[model samples]
Target: MEVFLSICLGLGLSASSGFRVFLPMLIANIAAMSGWISPAESFAWLATWPAFFALLTATIAEIGGYYVPFIDNLLDTIATPAAIIAGTLLSTSFIQIDNPVLQWGLGLILGGGTAGMVQVGTGLLRLLSSKTTAGLGNPVVSTAENVASFGLSGLAIFLPIIAMVLVVLLILWLFRKIANLRKTK
Candidate 1:
């Protein structure tokens, strides 16, 4: 049961990484520190005091920067790759599998790949909005991302399975919208 819950948390956190990378990490790190979640032994490093401080700072900085006008879009440009790496690392960090190969494979594929896909999808929306609305739609995008980040972070620590299901739904929805846009063009 513990393992299952942890995996679910990992999936939820990975999904959240798509919206705001550091937000979920900060949440998870705090949870682990408080013993709300029991990460794998290897992830014991996350419970350290310094890790907590770093994530807290990063989370605050990232979210605050996203509230700015043009700066939000610029952050997304660089955040894309960083989100992918964070997603994978966070997923694998909580996983405690005896099989080394399986751990890294799933970390990169499902964790990193899913986060990267979602990040790129959101970035494309921002790009389209910038091109069409002249960047006026950025506030809406930023707000939605903040809601998603908070929602997924909470779900990751509490109802992880539900969060994973939501991630799948979000992916499908994004894909459909992207497809419709392509067809219209």
Candidate 2:
């Protein structure tokens, strides 16, 4: 049960990373520093002051970049891969499995996969919004993504089950939306 909860929390955080790579890491660092959460032994550095400040800087830059006009689209290309790496690290930090191989394997597969899928969906949404609204709606989308990343990261830390359920539902909804878009095209 503990392991299950850990996986849920990790995946939830990973999904949050998909929306914004650095936000989830910043939240986790703060949580760990405040004694609200404990990362794996190897990830103990995540709770340190240097890590906090670095993540803070990255988060601010990433969020601000998304508010820019053409820069947001350019950032998405780089963010996709960065989000996957962040997701894998976030998930791996929570996993308590005895075997390093199994832990990293699951982290790479589930964590990376979840983050990648969400990132793809968000990129698509941004593209559609850019096309339909002449890029005027992008700031709104960026704001929503930021909010979702923060909310999901908090929920993942405090309520793993609920966060996991929300992530699952979000993935399902994204898949359905993509399918519908395919049908139209």
RMSD values, in order shown: 1.6, 0.7
Candidate 1 residue pairs in backbone clash: none
* Candidate 1 regions with alpha-carbon error over 4 angstroms: 1-3
Q: Say which candidate scores most in TM-score.
A: 2
Q: What is the TM-score of each candidate against the true structure?
A: 0.92, 0.98
User: For model 1, how does the per-residue alpha-carbon lDDT over 74-140 read when each residue is reduced to its tens digit?
Assistant: 9999999998998898888776676868887877787788788889888887787788888888888
* Candidate 2, superposed: residue stretches over 4 Å from native: none
Per-residue CA lDDT of model 2 for 7-113, tens digit only, reads: 99899999999999999999999999999988999999999999999999999999999999989999999999999999999999997787999999999998898
The CA lDDT at 147 in model 2 is 98
Best by lDDT: 2
